[model samples]
Target: MAYKFEVYTDKAGEFRFRFRASNGEEMFGSQGYKQKASAMSAIESIKAHAPGATIEDQTK
Candidate 1:
């Protein structure tokens, strides 16, 4: 796959997710969630909203 979401527990034992590319480089990560369901919901929200997201390009 060109990209994917990975869920895992941190050293602190919190649930978190990271978005990665095919080359296994991380693109971004989510804040830790108390429950796995909350983390999954966050992923779904991103999937539903990302397609319509605009690039603000604040660096310009």
Candidate 2:
């Protein structure tokens, strides 16, 4: 796969998520969550909403 989501415990022992490319580069990372389920939910939400999201070029 070219991309994937990873969930892991941080140094602070909190659950977090990161989206990585096949080459192992991180594309994005999520805020720490108190529960694993919350992190999973955040991933699902991104998958569900990202398809219709628009790109805004604010750097112009």
Candidate 3:
């Protein structure tokens, strides 16, 4: 199966999304959003624009 991705309201009330490889390794990229729609959009965009890329590293 593809890496499992997830989105939810963070404690800061912002929308948070993340995904990890099968080995429990996160993808690489600094990504996040303040809105749910943006985060969702990012998920699609990332898949399209950065194929095979992972958010293994990001900044808060």
Return the top candidate by TM-score: 1
Best by lDDT: 2
Better of 2 and 3 by TM-score: 2
Q: What is candidate 2's lDDT per residue for 1-60, written digit by digit as tens?
A: 689999999999889999999999999999999999999999999999999999999999
Clashing pairs in 1: none
The TM-score values for the models, in the order shown, are 0.88, 0.87, 0.63
Clashing pairs in 3: 26-56, 27-54, 27-55, 27-56, 28-54, 28-55, 28-56
- lDDT tens digits by residue: candidate 3, 1-60: 568677777767888777878876877532557778998897788778886766776675
Off by over 4 Å in 2: none
Model 3 residue 59 distance off true place after TM-score fit, in angstroms = 19
Clashes of 1: 0
In order, the Cα lDDT scores of the candidates are 0.95, 0.96, 0.74
Q: Quantify how close model 2 is to the true structure by its C-alpha RMSD in Å.
A: 1.3
Runs of candidate 3 with Cα error greater than 4 angstroms are 28-32, 52-60
The 10-residue segment of model 1 with minimum total lDDT is: 6-15
